[model samples]
Target: MGSNAPSSAAQLAARAELQGFVQVTDSRAPLYARLAVGLADDTEAVSLLAAAPASARIPVTLFAAIHDLLLADPSEPLAAWYPNLVATPRTDDPVPAARELCRRRRDDLLALVTTRVPQTNELGRSAVLLLALAALGDEMGPLALLDAGASAGINLIPDRLRVDYDGHQVGPGPLALTCGVRGKAKADRLPSAVPVVADRRGLDLRPVDLGDPEQVRWLEACVWPDQTDRFDRLRLAVAEVRRTGVVVQRGDVITDLPAALAQLRSGHPVVTTSWVLNYVGEDGQRAFSAVIDDLGRDRDLTVVNYEEPDLTPGLDWSAELATESLSVLRVLRWRAGERSVEYLATGHPHGYWFSWLD
Candidate 1:
């Protein structure tokens, strides 16, 4: 019985994490919020979550796993409550049905929670990336984008998607992404036209293959079910990516930086990382910085990082910014062996909105 005490304690901790997630989640994602609340009190659910690696033992990962199952088979009773599955989600409690599914599909859920990592590949973030690219293009001319940790490389083609920045539109697209503009940034600041993409390449440890339905389903599962618009946009982005194939080399971003940079033949090389550094640890982040600095010795280079302020090293931005849900958009440029860092903007982690800083 004493040996079981540690496991029991771990379940309690995992349950607490779920309760906390419910507090911070957007009020609009009521279904997930409610599930988190219910799952917090479910012994079986908490135990399943506790079995996952400490880093993967989060409400989002667990919920996404369940979402993936539903996406594959929405015939379950709980599917009726998922907005992505049904046009009108029932208002009644979904916890009972959710619990039943967890009990019946324990082994499947366990496999997913233990192995899968959440990969949002949020297309909304394309707005943030596009803005940064345009700013760089104003000075650098055409740019070759090298995406670090670019899952499926959806962001590799932001110029191909239509982005409406408060009535200002960019891209000729199949997918339209909208970001609310705030603060001092002006639409006129963007280039008269979208930046010319000399080339686009991506480096990821495990890049998603758009051709695989299961792989694509996991990407969709990562999105909250209540955000139907995000789910729809993801579908459009996937179609666009399928139409224009992207090359995502399977390699570590830190060690493979130079090789990836070599693939770009012309135009300024711009490397972008979004929500990727958090997984790389502090040492990896430092190494990535070192690699960029080393490569910049002979030529001009730029790195645009959209990451949590604290997770991103070498920048002295306020600690307060890290505490907020917002992610910072920072641009680092190397000219003549000199490095300069600029804090460009702050925005929603998913890039639904942003407040630019001059």
Candidate 2:
């Protein structure tokens, strides 16, 4: 290979931004990431982070490998590196372990980070979706769900997770997920039971298979090392999936949606997505909307997304919370050439917490 490009200031700025994100929302993963970022200039870390292909979250994948190593062997060197991990967490500088892994497994690490997308189907995010479903409980009952970019389709089983809000609570499943309401969302709380989901299916370019150990291993690898709560929830969620697997197909969302829609068994059709539209360009986003619109010509369609306003048109509000920087989400219903938009909540990227708004 020719002379590799030098680390750029832009990449460093991004790393700084990511560090801030982890510092606020995460605990242990940030430590290892900080160490890796500090050492970026010395190695090809900057090049590796900056030169990522489409859908590949380089930083998440990079740390995921380190996290997996720690999980793979909860022993010295790696064991003490991340204290926040559920299996082994000890407060200590993980720089040495991170450096050693990067040095010894450079080629392997690069391959994992470059080839794979940071696909995480966290149980925490289910709260955000649940809140939206709660809001639409009366209007759409016994719902049929179609999730775009639904990796592993873990989220397709919303009814399986439990949520406890201020005055209302939903579900009593094995996960029993938790989410608190903030700001105006407190008033927007729904009835105890969200609209029961009739059936659910997901669309992904590369859908993960929980049956395959390799695929499941990659899913575990995508999780932040310190988020033991999510890790524990994911285990149950995966088990739930095994007991009742969801249908996640390998195809383009826009191209495959019509066919997928045709196969629905019953209930009103609702399309959902979160942290997905940002990856697509403006044209693709508009095309997706257009497809939904096309479908809306004859039948009713409901859409919801947690999205950054920069890419999603008509969603022109920012979170008042100065500390948190994440996508603003809302619920939309399209029918008879008309669309209705409503604010859902502002939340952490992983749905750790939600500030509900009307």
Candidate 3:
């Protein structure tokens, strides 16, 4: 039987047993995330967190520490584990063996109720660019668009709202945006062509169906708590998505991509995911790149990737702590044989940015 219900004592016992679980390094996540998850009542967060593999349990344990030390006793030094946690190096790690006995307990925790969440990650860039295209080109007219890694049909609703980019803005409009940098972008004043949106479809091997309320709610909770802007953006995006009939289907892109590409209208622009690429691993990235290289040469495609540029170790765990989103994201624009530079931005889960790609 699945462990989908646990008494309060069972939960506390589990936490106590795993008390030794501590953050090894602050490199992977920020203190706030640690605090939010670690210290916040596990009775409240455990259900959602339990969905993650046991290998992820220690992170949850350390998260509890953040709550205990920061919230419960702010004046007390977190010295016992702070520096050690931040300085410890990362390697292939796993949850302590003790977790195996908590299987049923973990299952029980995952059954909690959650909020409705929309599509997230770099796939969000596809819609962001469409707005940029209209805002920059001075056209709101319908534009043909396509997306890869369309996890759920949700991202297919990119054209339904107004957007503000780095201050200079546009939209179906009135969308408010705040940025960390200055210099108002030259945007949206012109009568932008109304996008005669001919098409918007996506491909994903394991596409999530937003139509399912429980699953959608789980997706919402999966969203990092600190990024409230993301929550708002998702709210707007989902509202539009609910009104549309955009479709997504199950299929491996490596084998089915050419066929999917064939469905796009000629001369129309295509956009794919920055977040999906990170999950593609080494060979998958090369193969996908090769496919795009061949297809992009003859098509008017703009692949906007809001992804990490390299595998180098250092990263801003602070933003991760704050928003549960990547703070520093490199935007890559690839078309034909050439790739041009776009500025890096601190990303939000919902599509807001503090920086710009200029």
Candidate 4:
């Protein structure tokens, strides 16, 4: 989570410089605006927000992502992405203005990158998927879980908040999964996992520590304003992390997988991630899958992912851009040579969706 208060003038400058690059890529601006705010770097963002007051309506967390995206690679789509944002309608708050800009530029960027990258990882998908994994373990016992792009480790605390499905209920709170399942199933089998035993952890290139109030707020600001449950879930997750402490190491996922696995019990099932792998390039994807494959061959392993099902690389302008609805969530389970997959849900990467997997 780092310090929400930008650490120094130099750090703020670096973050702003990163935002400048992200804004160039229409896909990156909404997030860039938020990260610029979160890192406490965007004075223009702050000033704009103060005047517009649309900050509450904005997806502020995207800014941090924009910072990361630009810092990682600053060419191609981003150059066009930034200006697209400038063309978007400006609201009272800098955040929404930034988000609208991203939305406006999404089509152009989608054409630019085609569908090579995934756009979002909303908490609703993560919540259901984790519950499903826990239920799957009801058949195989509990497992050790590792997440990539964990961003403050919020998803790791899925058990801490409440989840409901139709008439079924689960969680430390009362929230439930509302998506309709294909077949009639017994609600009794749903997970009633005690928050205590879930061995959860994650790795993020920029791991956000939830212990800090300011950092937590920035994460809070990232949630869309319309979803009250999402906000509640995020708050519960932060509280859980603060109370129980989470194992979120600050490092690259590829380099850290081996060590992360070493910490898990040998027989415990290993679940990799949800909506985090898409940011990685081809080589990194292969290396990561290879690591997971090796783990499955030698150790108990399962991969639960909620990523865009389509990987079509060419430019597809016909597809709708800007919203997270384009992304589909899928789960992968490993066993020897078999790679089992099930489509679970779909929505904005960070927006809302129904889950049929539970």
Strongest candidate by TM-score = 1
Q: Per lDDT, what order, best first?
A: 1, 2, 4, 3
Model 1 steric clash total: 0
What TM-score, over all chains together, does every model reach? 0.91, 0.81, 0.58, 0.57
**Model 1 over residues 1-358: C-alpha lDDT tens digits?**
2332325666878888888987788687899999998888787788888888887888888898899899999997889999889988899999999899889999989999899888878888888877788878878998999999999898888678777888887777667888888886576765355677889899999999888898898899999999999999889888887777788888999999899989988889999999998888877777888888898887899999888866665434455565544788888899998988887788988899898766
Model 4 Cα lDDT, one tens digit per residue, 223-288: 433244565666655666667677788767677877776776533555546566656765666677
Ranking by TM-score: 1, 2, 3, 4
Displacement of residue 228 (Cα, Å) in model 3 is 4.0
Model 4 scores a TM of 0.57
Which model is ahead, 2 or 4, in terms of TM-score? 2
Which tens-of-lDDT digit does each residue in 237-270 have in candidate 3?
A: 5555656777666776656776786776643555
Candidate topping lDDT: 1
**What TM-score, to 2 decimals, does candidate 1 have?**
0.91
lDDT of 2 by residue, 1-358 (tens): 2343345664554354444444544455566555654544434554455545534534565666556655666663765645444345556665666667667767766676667767777767778888777666577678898888888888888777777765467887766777767666544355466578888888888888888876787788677656667777787888897776688888777778888887778878888888777666667777787788788877888887876665554333334422334656677788676877677677776776777654
